[model samples]
Target: GEEVAQTPKHLVRGEGQKAKLYCAPIKGHSYVFWYQQVLKNEFKFLISFQNENVFDETGMPKERFSAKCLPNSPCSLEIQATKLEDSAVYFCASSQSGNTEAFFGQGTRLTVV
Candidate 1:
């Protein structure tokens, strides 16, 4: 069984500052996804990649938010300018494909002060 991994489990930044989140997809899994959780009951998919190529990005912001899943490297999700409203838990997930069940990492809790 494969599992997703994220770094900097918690992050705090001033409003208007930059915030970056790193994720290492599970070994052997090709699909990588990112999600933002603003509330306990809400999970918003941000973007997804299949083997270093973007597969779907329907929920991602056109600006500020960017992500990459390059080969041989840990995937990355960055917010160019963090706002107070951006304070939330960011989760990274991995799966074999879109149809497969996803395995999520312990979310990265980001706080914009």
Candidate 2:
């Protein structure tokens, strides 16, 4: 099992500002994912990448959210425009190909005020 690393445990931004979250996928794992948790029961899958190439992004917001998992760099999830509704815990996850469970990092809590 490998661990996903995330930076900046907390982020604060004003309305209309930008918020960026970073993730480091586990070594040897090819799939990396991002999710937004606004409530305990709700998790919105944001995007996924297979070794720097996007695999599935059906859940990503078309207008405001963007993500990348480029090689030799930390995977990043960014919100171009901050909103009060965007305040939430953003989680990063990673897994190896096939039959492997995904591992999540400590979420980055974003606050928009």
- For model 2, residues 1-113, the per-residue Cα lDDT tens digits are 25788988999999999999999988989999898899664999988888989988999887999999888899999999899999999999998992489899998999999
Question: Which candidate leads the pack in lDDT?
Answer: 1
Q: Backbone clashes in each candidate structure, one number apiece?
A: 0, 0
Deviation from native of the Cα of residue 10 in model 1, angstroms? 0.2
**Candidate with maximal TM-score:** 1
Model 1: clashing residue pairs? none
Give the least accurate 10-residue stretch of model 2, judged by summed lDDT.
93-102
Cα error, residue 6 of model 2, in Å, equals: 0.4
Looking at model 1, residue 47 earns an lDDT score of: 94
Cα deviation in Å at residue 51, candidate 1? 0.9
* Cα lDDT of model 1 by residue, 10-103, tens digit: 9999998999899998888889999999967499989999899999999998688999988899999999888888899999999876679999
Q: Against the correct fold, how does model 1 do in TM-score?
A: 0.95
